[model samples]
Target: MKRFAFALWLSAISLNAYADSANCHQKANTPESIAATMDQALQLKQQLNSQPDPVVILVRQGQDMSSRHLTWSHAGYAMRQPNGDWRVYHNLNTCGTAESALYIQGLYEFLADDLVNQSIAVLRPRSDIATALQTLLHSAIKLNLFHSPRYNLIAWPFSGPYQNSNGWLLEVFARANDAQVWSRNDARRWLQLQGYQPSIVSAGTFERLGAKLFTPNVFTDDQPTELLRKGNVGLNSGDSVIRFIAHYSRAIPGCEHQNLGESVCVYLSPGAKRREKIKNRPSRREKIKNRPFYANRAACKSAYLRRQVVPCGPSSRIIPISVRRSRAASAAAQSFALRASRRC
Candidate 1:
């Protein structure tokens, strides 16, 4: 974004080629139609490249929207784009030039099904992603996102330290199902049935959310598991609070504030249980590790679907409850969590 936002300025210039608008909403067929499909893929790649919602830092800003293409592992060094067509060659060890990186909006889109069809058969990250989804879901089923299908991956876009790490499993499953987000906790359980007992603590934004909150005391780390306490937990331990906050940042999707790991930069709402959990863990009352239910890893988590399996369809096709609606909350109470983690 930061990079390609200005340099390319090419989308407007390139659109002139397709003069007449053909309403071929139907899937494209035929060689010429197929070629057009490739063109469409290029366009999609360009559009995505130009305006990515970057869930991860590695998917930097302003990389070439159309230039970065993956040929696939089944092939050679060349990798293919999420689209089946439009292959581009690049290096794995290096970041690409402006002409190479496509600005895929919301890095998570690059990990979706509409973007990744079953036919591509090139980059099969299903196992890895499915496993992570299930592992994360294992813990999320206990959270408030347990039944809402729409709130699966990016459940807590804005939250506090205690509520930060509950939704990573949703993203893991969404990536696996090719669905951008999950609609129920049952899907999580179903994935578990497939042997996807996801329980990793790898650190990344737990949700692929759109809202970003700025807070102190949170850090986004490279590990798979969330480390709530950089060192140890204590009531007066500012550093411990900061680490907990950082873990929260990773727990949230689309969160970019991880450097200011100090100060009360954000005001998030921790659910009653989370509030109680924090109180019972790092406060002056007792050491977090000594607690009866001490979460040794502090690998924050989220919720999953109900037993009802909803087929993957359009975002607007059907209606279901969401995090904002179904959480067991009182009118005066909020379900948000607070977190603060930065590279700082």
Candidate 2:
């Protein structure tokens, strides 16, 4: 009896150690979690298969700290595979690098965000649009041609030089909807004409300068003029993409406006009745007009230049000839620098 009790005590100790190790690696990509998520993905796949429409777009709030204010930050198209499982097609940046790649992954892999909180959004287009989007997806050449390796985090909605993940989806969406849009530039023009607004990140001049100097992934040329003029940069976040889709497509009944923390599943069949047509919301330009004058171009430019220029003072360094013209000029330069630093 004594020996048996000692054996049981040893077993308990072993089990406790195993539990501790598991807890330490809880956030790591473990096979058990992946398998569980796969099961969930299969369930979601079945639900999507029941929809009358064949294709739906998925949007999720990104896990990055920078994406906290945005409603959604990533998007991908989901479609049923030959085996009946659903797969997502989208572009992803190569681990914070300037390179990007087209990814065709399972729903589980698509939703594999470290900060995911058990919720996602689904956008189902009208039957005709769904068919068109699927048709475009079938063309490898068309998809590959636009798959740019240069990933710009701040890519403008209307730019062609570089593409962000959401920007790629936006371009693909444009091609799927319009046959005339054969190139990225054409797609961008279409989006601009439709008044599609990209999400704006409020970055001061010094922050922008620091990012440009230190990070290869931050590209500013693609930012929208209005946003850049206000010391902010435009980004193709998932929420903005969903809004753009909502502006153009009809949302299925019971599928529009999903509550937070609830996963959305939509089924669209050919015979399914179309929901109400989505109206175009106000443009970013219209919204910005209501903001304070400090967000305007002149103020932003002054603030930006001040941050870029070094301060003039004896404590910091010798004053430049331009700043040494007079005490008033030196004071003005110092004031400008201070304001710029404050903004930063």
Candidate 3:
């Protein structure tokens, strides 16, 4: 029996290695980047992804995500034991289980597909599950995704078979807006196309927004101030450029406003244009789109509400975003049970 068990264990190890190798195994290997601009791209990705349906993984990866990344968007599944040690399968890049990779599967699932047929990125949703899956397979071979617990409350509503369905699809795109991952202009434009006016976002409110996006797994919003340093977004609070974009986004948030004047509570993309419509003296268009990331509801609510109060007066209709968490999300919070079950 002992001998048989030993052989079985070894065989299991070997097979595991092979599977991981096949998944993350990049032949030419993925191109790597050290540029700060990567932050902007990641920020955009976060906004687009929003609170991930598979919440637990995202929070784990968000910590120190600023580190240089080796792409395995083409990489495949590598299941490293929860132990910190790394492993690889078959013959691929040496990838082990880390928080970044754990949650990054969600992000990889999106980028693995050719969102763009041409040089431009595809902002549209993909409907072909088979084609989409193929794109994912290709990407899995090239990227390394990880999870970091340092980032708090990564949303992961999609897990197991529940992922990839249309119902979850809406949740994914909605999350992008929730996180302010897309610049406000990009988010506004995208949402407008989908007839979705996502909640307003604020410059420095990721934590609060994180609450809404990730459920069944929210970590503490307790990253130290020093550790909360912004990535290389090349943006700062109150910049003249940001202010201008904010101005437009506020006006054309969904382009559904009944009144184009102060009665409108929507935001516009920087370079968005009006269809030669009458009224509104200033051409309601700009040539660029840039907006801040949303981290918290308070901050986001403030940004949009201030405009409403000024123009539409206090009676402006604001949509309700649950400040309270879902029961499942609250239950999954780390340490909540530990503290409760063993109260001193």
lDDT of 3 by residue, 1-344 (tens): 43243233223221222112223333332444222223333443443243221111010011111111210111222122233221211111123221122232323332222211101111112223223322332343322111122211111212211111111222323333344322323333443455432212121344333332432222223333332354111111111112222232222233333232331222221112242233354442421121233334443454342332222232222332233345666544323433322321
Best model per lDDT: 2
Task: Please identify which of the two predictions, 1 or 2, would achieve the higher lDDT against the true structure.
Answer: 2
TM-score of each: 0.18, 0.64, 0.16
Instruction: Write the residue-wise lDDT of candidate 1 on 3-77 in tens digits.
Output: 332222222111110100111122335676445445444544443244222211111111122332211111101
> After TM-score superposition, what is the CA distance of residue 315 in candidate 3 from its true location, in Å?
54
Best by TM-score: 2
1-344 per-residue lDDT for model 2 (tens digits):
43243233223211121111112122677897677666656656766776666778887644433323665567788876677777788887665256777878877776555423334567778778888888877887888766677877767667658887888888888888788998888888988887888776576566666666655566677666677778777777776887778755654555534443122433222111222112245667765443323333344434334432343222222111233336667667766655543443
Alpha-carbon lDDT of model 1: 0.25
Count backbone clashes in candidate 2. 6
Give Cα-based local distance difference scores for all models: 0.25, 0.61, 0.25
Order of models, best TM-score first: 2, 1, 3
Candidate 3, residue 193: lDDT? 57
Q: Model 2 clash pairs?
A: 51-267, 51-268, 52-268, 52-269, 53-268, 53-269
In what order do the candidates fall by lDDT, top score first?
2, 3, 1
Against the hidden true structure, what lDDT does model 3 obtain?
0.25
